[model samples]
Target: MKTYTVNELLKGEQLLQQVKVNGWIRTFRSNRFIALNDGSTLNNIQCVVDFEDTPEDTLKKLNTGAAVCIEGTLVESQGKGQKYEVQVERIEVLGTSDPETYPIQPKKHSLEFLREKAHLRVRTNTFSAVMRVRSALSFAIHQYFRDNGFYYVHTPVITGSDAEGAGEMFRVSTLDAKNPPLTEDGKVDFKEDFFGKETNLTVSGQLEAEAYAMALGKVYTFGPTFRAENSNTSRHLAEFWMIEPEVAFLDLMGNMDLAEDFIKSVIRYVLDHCREDLEFLEQRLLQEEKGKPQNERSEMSLIEKLHFVLDNNFKRVSYTEAIEILKRSKPNKKKKFQYIIEEWGADLQSEHERYLVEKHFNAPVILFDYPAKIKAFYMRMNEDGNTVRAMDILFPGIGEIVGGSQREERLDVLKERVAALGIPEEELWWYLDLRKFGTAVHSGFGLGFERLVLFVTGMTNIRDVIPFPRTPQNAEF
Candidate 1:
């Protein structure tokens, strides 16, 4: 007999057909009703077991987390929670779980408790729903880019380049670490290494994508990015995924429009296609915030927040204007901000970004033209000689979700900026060569894939969105 999934069966289709199904038993209530789920959907199929007909030994194996395959006839259910169920004829246990030692139970498990069992957490309702949404969001990203005439670029994961210039790199070396080859100048020799030069995992793919964008007109890269920052906060991860898109002949304003439209499109896609999973996550977030104080709870539900972003226009303000506003605002004036905003050159912190989005503008806001001293050297210098053409998109709950700028296309100006910033020019000779050979005005932005999922799924920590989080001092699988 052909096999069927729980999702296909629950669609109220072709009733009374013989079927074979495989799933794990979620609950064995009264030794007759087996709640089985195959991870195809959030809901499970209730399998009615006949105690008098089935052997006692086979019935004893029906427990929580036990994998089983069942052959039965579809029938209408009288249960309170579900609509249709399967009337079981023959059953076989694919795998058995000891109820006495199984970590996951039928009751709700705390997110903290679930992280420890990362391998098995997907068996639960919460993680399963989250992963499904995550999978859908990835698809939406590719679809949005593909439909818009953007070519996908597969950038290298390991490189001899430090694109960010922040120097937070995980060195990719194949030489002896304790003691090995040394140079005559009394320094470790990277010349004899595996690649014949020093290399590390890429922190961002923007530079490589820019090279492709100039050739392909429009290109994007969605891949893994690595960093070695020793941050144990709920926000930082050693490994994460980044979505970067570069376009030729696009300026800062056009970049802003593309960013906003792209974000809303993918979010709307998830809202439309993953309705059942999103509904489950929405209810989950609602229940989690019940015990918190009214002031501490989320102002809007998950779906409400998603809809607000889709329907609203992101407020745009120059960095200078934002500074003046912050200087006169209640947070700065009343001495409430942790990093008090005082002058124009002050880099905006999470606290400041949150205030602008949640309280000041009361909507999603984009701050642009940041100080040249704070932003990267690749950003095009403004006419004022003090600010760069950089923009950061800030959301209400999460502070900054997107960061990008118009890149410097002038060869002389870029070389001067590179030298002034004390960044090595020879290592980035190819990067500078792009400007030397027919460089046109181009722009791109980088978005953290996990952060977008966090905003959509109502997940708090960054680690929860990833499958196996690699953090400081925690690499346990």
Candidate 2:
């Protein structure tokens, strides 16, 4: 007999049609009713099996988490509560699961406990819903970029240099740890390693995407990225995904427009395609203390918030103006900030970013023209002597979702900035060569994929969204 997907069964119009469905039992109540989810959709089919129809011995052996195939007739329920249910004709146990051995039970399991059994957590209702949403969101991302004439670029995972320049890298090596290869000066010699030099997992694909964008005019990369920052906070992850888009002949405004449109499209797509899953989450999985409330928070949901941010023109202010607003704000009155916001130079922290987006603008805000001394050397220096033409997109819940700018196209100025930043000229010769050959104006942004997922799903912790999350001192499977 041909098998049907659970989602297909739900959408089918043929009631009382004989169908065969296979899945693990989610829950079985009173041996007469069983809820089975195939992982094809968030909605699980409730099968009504009489004790006489299912042999007493067979019924006794069946348990939650056991894989089973059911031959049933789909019927519109005359019962008041549920719309439809399956009337079981015959059942076959493909695999029996011992209730005591199964890690997931019908009882409430904490997120910490769930994380330990990450491999099996997807079988649960909450995780099944989350994974479906995650899959839908990923598809939406590719669709948005592909529809907009952006070429999908696959950048390398193993790289020779750090793209973020943040100095947090997980080294790739084959040398013995106890007695490693050493140079004449008693330093660890990376030349003896597999790559014949220092190599590490890529922190970002932005730099490589820029090269592709220069040639292809528009390109985006979606891939795994690593960071070795020893942070155990809810927001920090050692390994996570990043979506970066680079466009040639695009200025700062164009970059922002693309970012805004890309984000909004993904949100709209996921909301439309994963309505059932999202609704399930909004109703049961989410709560006020444990999860988000079902009631709509804003005039628009998170998906609509993206459209609102994109449809309405964004508020753009220079770093100087933002600092002035901060200085005048009430929080600045009580205690001295660790990074004071002054006129010419000061780094913006999470608090300052939140204040601008949440308090001052009451919407998504873009702050640009940061002091060159603080920003990356690749950012284009503004006409003003002090600041560079970099921009950061700050959202209400998350501080900075995107960081991008028009790149420094002039080789002479770029070289000067590189020198002033104390980076060796030889290390970046290939990057400078692009400027020497044929450099047109190019811009791009590095978006934290987890942050975007958090904002869209209303998930508070970044760790919950990702599977097998890696954090500081936590790499347990």
Candidate 3:
């Protein structure tokens, strides 16, 4: 007997051949047909049983979610929904799921209910399709970087430096929380901590990727990063994976070109390879949008949306220009935006970013040359003494999918900026040393992996894309 996955059997020849198949039952119909899936594909293979030959007790064990092995003859399916199926000659129940206890059944379940049972949510069609597309996108990332002569760099997850200056880091300590060591002023002494210095989970890998990029020429980091902010929004996650690529001898304009090419390549890869999964998700999205008003629904289908980005060039504009447009727009004059744009230096909010990309441009927009005071400390200072070579790529629905800048290459300028931001000069000595030694024109950008997933899979919540989401207070497996 030969073993076969549900997907393999479904694609096999029409001739009757003995095959052994193993999978979990999705649904049992009329006590004769079994819809089984092994996760190789979204489609399930039908297993028709001869009730006359199969024992009554054995038929009762073939409940939904039951694990079973079957020896069957693969032949053309007589069913209307499928082309090929298995005519079982023998069946063995490896595990049985009780109809009363199994959380997953043949019925429509809410996304909230599935989230509560995340451990078993992958067995569902929606979660499984999302995961498959996520995996494909991840592979596409590695392949894209590798094919483009970029090295995959692994940065440390824990560090003493704060890359983003947000100070929303999760402390990694082993000392006693109730009563720890104290200093002379009765303050909690961090000198006695595990690392001999205060350290937390890293917020970004861009700084470290820059260090490697100087030597390697081209480097990218794909790993988990953490933030400790207590945000319960659908888009905010305490822990998420990040993709950062830094290149040597590259300027701000080159950085934008690289980002556009990289994003389009990976998205196109998913479109070509994950067609079945995307098609399933597309239909699921159509069903979901039926509940919403016509104006709120997406105008383009999922496939059309992906192709639109690949075919069109992203609109580029300066931050100063964007500010002027926002100031004169109807939203600002009507006071519709929650954070109205009043001046040039005001930080752009999500609503503003969406309005720029969706309404003003109707395409992906790249806004560069942001105010230095509002951006990070490492960005290169422009000649105007006000703006930095910073850029943010805003998508139609997603506000900010990418953020990056041309790093400060001048040793004195970088030191001054770091000191002015109140960051410890000693903590980032190595980062500064890059400028001192042989730092050239280098630039990099960070893409939130989950947000990219949300864009491609048409998912609204960031929690739904990640397998085990680590949010404000929820860490359940």
Candidate 4:
């Protein structure tokens, strides 16, 4: 007897061979047909059972979500929609599920309902396909970096530095919460806590990755990063993964090239390897779009959108140029935009970004040379003294998929920017030390992993792409 996965059995032929399979029952129909899935693929294996010979007790336990092992013979399926079927010779119930208690029934469920049942949602077709694509994208990310001479670095999850300087951080404390140590000024003192200083979950790993890039020339960090912003939207997540890559000698132009190439490589990999899953997600998106108004529907299908990105060159436009375009656009002119683009220095919103990608350019766009005041302190200041060499890669549906910049290498300039932002110099002494010692014109970008998955999977909500989404006031498994 041989053990084979449902994927292999479906794609290969071992006619009349005795095989063993372990899986959970997806559905049992007519007291003779069993649909078993083992998490190996999206398709399930139809196992034909001999109801007359099989014990009644065993048959009774073959309900949905019940784990089972079956000794069966591989044979061609008499039914349609699948290639192979298993003729069960012996059946053993590993774990039984009460049909009345199982929440994931064989019917369409809303995304909200499936989210509450996140633990069992993977058993469904949509979630399982999503997760498979997510896994493929993750693997492609690492493979792309590895093949491109980038060393993977694991950055700290807890740090004292506020990388984004937004200050929306979840504090890590070990002292008593009710009555903790207080400074003479009556503020809660963090000196007595672990690490002997204030620390929180990291918002971005770019700062740490910069240090490694300086030492190793090229390095990347792919790990979980936290943001404590109380945002309840389709795009925000309290805890999410980030992919940051830093190169010591790369400039802003080189950074844009790298980001574009990296994105295309990963998408290409997924398109080649995860075709089945992508097709399933594409059809899912098509069916979802049918309910929306004709004007609101997507102009391109999900797979067509993917190919469009791969086939076209990303249009590189300056932030100043984009501002003018948005200002002249009908939406901003008619006050239809939620936040109209009024001036050159005004920050561009997601609406504006989507306009550039989806409407104006009709291709991927990379906007650079943003106003220095709106960008982080690390971005390199251009000669104008008003703008920095920061760039954002905008996709059609997703606004800003990748954000990067050539870092400020001058110690005095960086220190001035840090002081202007009210960030204490002592807190970033180590970061300042990099510029003091051997700083170069390094550039890097941070890509929100969920947003990438959301784009690739054509999933509207960020929560659906990740396994256990951590959002504002919602952390249930």
Candidate 5:
């Protein structure tokens, strides 16, 4: 009379009570054996049904992907293959799936093919497990922040000022693009735009979150951020979610500690709650086809790496030190490095970041105090005058998963920095006003949510973690 989850059936117990289960047939071997999965868990329930007891017409109507409701008695499995199974008493066909029409079958389908059916791909083992892990990770993020006394803040999606000032934003306007409003000087008149000014999708919510954090003492924003870059790489996505946490009265070191703790908490939560889904991925998805054993390490490895890096007070080196290390290592000797790391002011590429974290440090490495010329204007300037107190957390597999810095709380410093960067000071009046009124020392970091999911799940491509991923040229359903 009551529905039993597939995970509940996994326990070895005989059921005296009647149970109803609804799921799609994963694999049906002959008339008596059917493997059904309800999206409740990674493991499917093998339902043993006798076709002779049921109608032959019903057996003929059943196919893979067809929805079915089974009233059955749960019993211990005597079969050698599986642990427990369900003995069907009454079978009801809720929906029939045509064998030829259903794209998903028992046979293997390529990842490219699955990408085409992004909506339907969740039914597959790999995507299903990924989605579950993604959900768990999101919950963990909120839980970690909430438990640590952080207020959740929602910032505006359409913003007038570019947070990153990287010129990568999708313009939102109702004005004609061919012959837009213009002033007598022939300059595009932003006053006539829909919002009476230029507005685009927010690239990051860190700046806005900082204002709230200064008031609330601690605040975080988890929302979708947009980037209009046209690079069609595995790592680049047109739209992605970002988790930005800002804390008042916090320095760069405190910011890094919060990031490390947040990452470890999410990793621990997923590994604890989604054990079945992760086990399925380890056994079926990430494993080699030849049955080569995948390296299985305890979940503690994630926390261990985080603690090891945090405990050592991450090797704080200026951009100059990084360059020196690169030079001494003889990066030119390695033919694999695309660009030679020579000068002090070179923007650290992904290759260089990976080299620092994976090779040099042999652990998670936090590279801080970047050259002010390369970093954003809001970053606090160091005593050295050239470098800013910006920090980037680099892991072994991914280069820069988290990026953050202490804000220039001083109004004079912020205004000077904005003027030097040639950014319009008029557009940033409200942001500057925050400093003018009552700005305390504050720091924050932005963690790319998709990248975090990829790192925890061991997913290689960014596209795999996000459902219906919006890449440069790809926006297929």
Candidate 6:
């Protein structure tokens, strides 16, 4: 007898063959039927028990969440909703879960409640589907990059330089907190720290990837990045994964093309490979939105929204043009926007980005040439001297799905921007060296991997999509 997964046995490939299966019991009904799942698929395989021949002790241990191994002959199910089941001839309990203590139950539980039990949330249908789609999307990301002549690069997780230059970084010093080494001026001395200097978790891999792109021509990094921002919003996460791709000679326009093509390619792969999980999530979203008002609901279903992105070409609009449109739109005129688009330099919020995508363009929109002051120091300065060659790809629900810029390859111009921002040149000397040696017109974008997962899975909260969400003041498990 060969051991088979619930997913394999459910396929009816070896009907009449004796099979051994191991899974956690989902439900044991009437002491004769066991619904078993082994995390192989969302669907469970029915294991019909022989109550007459099975020992009473063995049957008693076959409760929900109990791990069990069943030796049975596969047969076509006479039951409804499923095609095949197992006729159990022998059974052994691997681990017994106490029903009274198990946190997960068969009934519908609140997402909030599930978050508390994040350790075991994957056992639920919604989360199982979500994680499966997440896995597929991960594979799709690497596959797309590999097939497109890009090399995968692993950037350091801890570094001395701040990539975002926002200064909201989690310190990685292995020094005493209360009684640390003091400098001559009485400030905590970082010279005695583990790395002999200050370091923190990386905020983004773009800077490092740029270095690699200079050598490798095309390279990408898929890894975890940290932020110390104290935000409790549904969209904010203290820790998240980012997919950043850097190309040696790609401009802003070419960067936009790559972002669009890359997103569509991975999404199409998920649509092709993870249909069952995606369909399950689609229905889950439909049910979740049923209680909301008609105006608040999505016009297209989850699957429809994904196809809409793939089928349509993203509209390209300049920052100045978008400001003009927003200033003249009904939302701005009627004071419907929470943050009014009063001027060109005002950073666009989620509401403004949503209007451009959902109303103004009625399609995905890529806004470019953001004001230099609002963008980071690395973006290429435009000829006008007011804006940088930066672009943000906005989606229907998520405001900005991708952000990128043509990095400033001109050594003098980049130094000016860095000095203007008061960033010390020494902190980024290695980065400046790339421009000194062999810099070309290069561009890349950072896609928040969780946001993409959120969009694909129709998961509203950023926390629900990640395995262990690190948020403000909450680091449990």
Worst 10 residues of 4 by lDDT: 7-16
Q: Tens-digit lDDT track for model 4 on 89-204?
A: 99999999999999988899999999999999999999999999899999999999999999999999999999988999988879899999999999988889988998899999
Q: Candidate 2, TM-score vs. the true structure?
A: 0.93
List, in order, the clash count of every candidate structure: 0, 1, 0, 0, 0, 0
Models sorted by TM-score, best on top: 6, 4, 1, 3, 2, 5
Q: What are the per-residue Cα lDDT tens digits for candidate 5 across 1-477?
A: 888787777765445556788999988777889899988787788899988898988898678999999998887777867787888999998999998889999888877888888888889988899899999999999999999999999998999889998999999898898989899999989899889988999999988998898789999999999999998777888999999999999998888888877877787787779877777665553343334334332233333443444455344555678788877675546755787876788898888887787678776777888999999999998888899999988876578889999888999889999999799899998899899888889999999999988776666678889998998778768
The reply for model 1, stretches above 4 Å from the true place, is: none
What does candidate 3's lDDT look like per residue over 1-477, in tens digits?
778888788887644999999999999999899999998899999999999999999999999999999888999987699988999899999999999999999898998898899998999999999999999999999999999999999999989999999999998887899999999999888899999888899999989999999999999999999999999999999999999999999999999999999999999999999999999999999999899999789877788778878887999999999999999999999999999899879999999998988788888999999999999999999999899999999987779999999999999999999989999889999999999898799999999999999999988899999998999779988
- Candidate number with the higher lDDT (4 or 5): 4
- Error of model 5, residue 123, in angstroms: 0.9
Give the candidate number with the greatest lDDT.
Answer: 6
Q: Rate the local accuracy (lDDT) of all candidates.
A: 0.93, 0.82, 0.93, 0.93, 0.83, 0.94
> How does each model score on TM-score?
0.98, 0.93, 0.98, 0.99, 0.92, 0.99
| Ten-residue region with minimum lDDT total, candidate 5 | 294-303
Model 5 whole-model lDDT (C-alpha atoms): 0.83
Q: Model 5, residue 372: what's the lDDT?
A: 93
Clashing pairs in model 1, backbone N/Cα/C closer than 3 A: none
- Model 4: residues with Cα > 4 Å off, grouped in runs: none
Quote the lDDT for 266 in model 1.
95
- Using TM-score as the measure, name the better of candidate 3 and candidate 4: 4
